[model samples]
Target: MDSNKAKNLEQILESSIKDPKDLTRYLYYRKKLKEEGLSDFISILPLGAAINWARANSVWPLTFGIACCAIEMMAVGASKFDLDRFGSGVFRATPRQTDLMIVAGTVTYKLAPRIKKLYEQMPSPKYVIAMGACASSGGPYTQLGYQVIKGVDKIIPVDVYIPGCPPRPEALIDAVLLLQDKISKTIPQQEAI
Candidate 1:
């Protein structure tokens, strides 16, 4: 069979196989085709854009809570605020499984290295939200305390900074929405011709 026919057959086989690994590989190729602008024939399904939209909406956050702000962070997941509405209420316990890392408390100098390690463990395209004054700038400890790190950004690259000793749940929700907006605007990398 010609290359195009062979590829089509492979896609069909993969789709029907019911194996998670095969499905993942098929999806990867589909994403590549869309990125190269070679998927006009498949325009009926904007798979690439749909994938990006799904990713932006369903951001799974890593669970990392350090101090008082941790309380506020938890509050965001409670029913009253309903962070699930934004598709980010599910907090993953493992760094490898999450795309967002919320630094929700004060970071001490001793813990900075550990936090950095955790951030490094996360996969690429991951985001970090510094979720309180303590996490953003060490709160009352900034410059005055010897043990507290001035900011979480010093340890890991922070994407958003929510200010407040312990920011209201609504503020956290706003930060998440802003992150979703940022995620939605990202352009997929084009494959080299």
Candidate 2:
């Protein structure tokens, strides 16, 4: 089946339904196909479905804020920047639950290992955005603060770094848009990197 046929998210939602509020017709089709030992044909659904689903639902983020920049991160999710417009407004609390980790504030030495652990917990295809100067190069803290790490990137490979003491919400939105653009260009490999 052509992916163009699945462009209507509503139709995809309709076909994917299951049970009481569910897909009686779909289940019937599945059962008939199964009993006939034609499950090989059914395998294509997951492939097509996964591609469709990822385009729509990819980039769940871990919002780890340690300082002023966190507010900018919050503003991106609010009415103005509206991070939801790109499906990344959901601020995931746990690293295990998100793939896009936006380090919006200062990352101190004490927090470096925690950040590393969280990065490890995030599933494959993960990305890290070092937001604000505090998170990027430790901002003004780099001059005076001995405790602050020079940047989150000192400990993690940063995908995008928004440079500002606390970057504006618009900057965060731009960073996310860049991330989206990158995601769109990505192709799957035979094996995970």
RMSD of each: 11.2, 10.0
Highest lDDT against the true fold, candidate = 1
Judged by TM-score, which candidate is best? Answer: 1
Clashes of 2: 1
Q: Give the Cα-based TM-score of candidate 2 against the true structure.
A: 0.69
Cα-based TM-score, every candidate: 0.73, 0.69
- Runs in model 2 deviating more than 4 A are 1-57
lDDT of residue 190 for candidate 2:
38
Query: Which pairs clash in the backbone of model 1?
Result: none
Q: What does the lDDT come to for candidate 1?
A: 0.82
Tens digits of per-residue lDDT for model 2, 107-126 = 88888899898888898778
Instruction: List lDDT for all candidates, in order.
Output: 0.82, 0.76
Q: Record all residue pairs in model 2 with backbone atoms less than 3 Å apart, i.e. clashing.
A: 18-22
**For residue 76, what is the lDDT in candidate 2?**
81
Whole-structure CA lDDT of model 2: 0.76
